[model samples]
Target chain A: MHELSIAKNIIEIVKESVEEKDLSEVDKVVLKIGDLSGVVPASLLFSLEAITNNTELENAGYEVINVPFIVKCNTCGKESNNEAGIVRCTLCGSNDTGIISGNELLVSEIILKN
Target chain B: MSVITVERKILAKNDEIAEQNRELLKQNDVFTINLVSSPGSGKTSLLEKTISLIGSKVNISVIEGDVQTSLDAERVANYNVPVVSIVTNGACHLEAKLVQDAINNLDLAKTELLFIENVGNLVCPAGFDLGEEMKIVVVSTTEGDDKPLKYPKMFRNSDVMIINKIDLIPYVNCDISKLKDNALLINPGLKIFEVSCTSGEGIKEWCNWLIENVKGKYIHQTQLVY
Candidate 1:
């Protein structure tokens, strides 16, 4: 799955960061995956485990924080979470809007031990 | 003896590579299209039809991304055009780094149009940018009309939506209007085309639009030199 490739990238990023900081082991990897990012946290973790085997992050635990999609309605000036993928304003029901957040796939923090 | 908090995005490296790929394509005056769809959505067939219609006039090359077999690359090879297949080895999508490598392996000097056919998947590919000029999403009528609503991100990211297998509409119950409506709802400026690759219906218009867009951009760039 694509998760494997994503996981591979995660490993590389973590490896580089750990090496740069001269850390010997990775304790945990915390990720923030947005609802609209189209990534499944469980699948990503599974792939991470398989790929990180025998690596410095082999014992590293994964923590996934789900980020809900939020949008701002331009016409109604309403801010709300857009779980349904609808762009309409909740108050005025106008289709005009702008995405405030979500669609993010990022490594929020990495814990490394000396 | 201390714990360091490293706050960084895992995809930062991949995104950096993708931006480099974008710059390379832009500098080469080449138009690249990353075509994404579900398996059996007539992606290769559409490419076949497209080559048959416009290959002689335009310089086209293809990079076929698949999880395993080279079957799709083999199909494009018959056209006598340059094609490179990158087997993902069970990966569901193509990343920017892979595309960058594929481009380096090919001859970009003679290529005007480069097509990267991504591994057939609706979700993951939407998140990764391959540094293409545009993203074309293919959804056949047989796959149903609710795809836009179900997979809104893919539809929203795509610049064009190709509704394939229109010939099968008679045998299957699919609402073309609903598909267009839903896609338009996601992206108001999305250009859509309904075609049947097997029957050669509407293929001409599709190819013509592609050529015109590319050539138009080329001409516009050339005019700026003076």
Candidate 2:
């Protein structure tokens, strides 16, 4: 899927962050993936593993933090987690709601072996 | 062990290029749209219909993205508008960088409205921004009404939803009203249009909307320039 592309982007980001450092020193890459980010964590991890093989980052693992889809009601100001992925207010039943979170695809942190 | 705080978007590079594209298109005053849909959702047919209806009124250009062939580009080229095709080889989606490269070969100066037809996919395209003013998602009646629920990200990210192949509504199980309801549940602000690209139904309304949008943005920009 597109996870390969995403994996490549992650690798690029990690490499950029590492700069002149050895990639072998990196322990794990922490990622914050949203429910609605159009990414499958397992697929992305597999892709990362497949592409990083024989490279310095082969031993590095990935930690994914799944973010829930949350929307804020424009009418009643109610913030609710949408497990079903509907963009409606949970309290007021209004359609005028805005997404507050759950679309994130971020590389939040990187850990190194001491 | 040491932990470094990155706190950066994974697609930050792509987003940066997309922003550059947005600025470039904005400076050229080209109103562009990123059209997305599932495979065989009649994206090309809708494009053909839209182009036929509004090609003379507006200077149109197209960027077609496919995994293999330039078939869609060839079809669009028949309209005599500037069209370019990006074959991703095996990639499922089109990124902003690909679009940035594709635009380089086009005549942006003569283009008023540009359409970037993303690879026939609902999942991957939702996450990638291709520097379009709006994203239009097409779903045909044969695809069923629950497409919005199944692909909420695509529906949520899109500004407009075009329900194509309405001519097959009688034979298909899709409930148009339910489709709209399902899509609206995910995106309240989505402007919807029902059309049968085959029978020429609702094409005029969609073209009119496109023309008005092109005029609206250009007028606002020209006023600022003057």
Candidate 3:
């Protein structure tokens, strides 16, 4: 699945940050994925587990936090949730809206050993 | 155990390189488009038709992305235009770093229009930005009308959604109006085009929109791009 590639990229990102911080090993990583991000969390974790095994970061655990999609109507300037894949305005019933959040794919934290 | 807040986007590295690509294309005055779609959505066919219709008037080049095979590149090459192929091996989507590498292999500066045909998958391609002026997602009538609600992220991120294979509409059990309404419900401002690559029904308007968005020719039109 495509989640494996994303998991690999996460490893790369962690590697870069770990190297930059001069950390010897990683213990845990925190990821915040938005509802509209198009990522399947279970599949991503499955790939992460398979990847971290038998490696220097073998003991590393991952935590994924799901985020909700929110949008603001461009016409009425009203903010609302868009998790169900509907991009309409909550107040004026206008479909003209811009998504303000919920497409996140961030690596927010890295638990490391001294 | 110590927790350090990295607060970094997992695809930040991709976005970082994408910025560099935008700068490179901006310097060249090239109008770049990242064309994305599900497999067998006629993305290649649309490009071939587009090139055939207006390739002579404009210096258009394409970077074709497929999991395996250079066949798509060969198809575009039949039009006597510059085309490069990026074989992703088994990856489902194309990344910006790969596109940056591909651009290095092409002469984008002299080209007026550059189309990056992304790997044929709707889900993964929406997440990666490849330094393009805009992203265009092509869906076929056979894919059904509920795709907008099914694959919301792709439609949400795309500036234009080209519903291809309209000629097959009569043969398929699909509602074209439902597709349009559903797409707009997901992205109200999504410029949509119903085109038949087989009969070349709506190629002119699409080409006109591309021409208008061309470098130094962009005069932001309030109306949708046909």
List, residue by residue over B1-226, the lDDT tens digit for candidate 3. 7777888888887899999999999899889999999999999999999998878778998999999999999999999888889999999988888999989988876688999999999899988888999999999999999999999989988999999999999899889999999998888889999899999988888888777677346455443333
Per-residue lDDT of model 1, residues B144-213, tens digit only = 8888888888888899999999999988878999988878766667899989998988887788788877
Candidate 1 or 3, higher TM-score? 3
What lDDT is reached at residue B212 by model 2?
Answer: 80
Distance from true location, Cα of B189 in model 3, Å: 1.2
**Which of 2 and 3 is ahead in TM-score?**
2
* Regions more than 4 Å wrong, model 3: A19-25, A73-78, B215-226
Query: Clashes in model 1: which pairs?
Result: none
Model 2 accuracy (lDDT, Cα): 0.91
Q: What TM value does model 3 have?
A: 0.92
Model number with the top TM-score: 2
Whose DockQ is higher: candidate 2's or candidate 3's?
2
Which lDDT tens digits does candidate 1 get at residues A1-114? 677778888877777666644534677778888787778888999998898788656788888988888778888788988654555555676667887777778877777665
Question: Candidate order by TM-score, highest to lowest?
Answer: 2, 3, 1
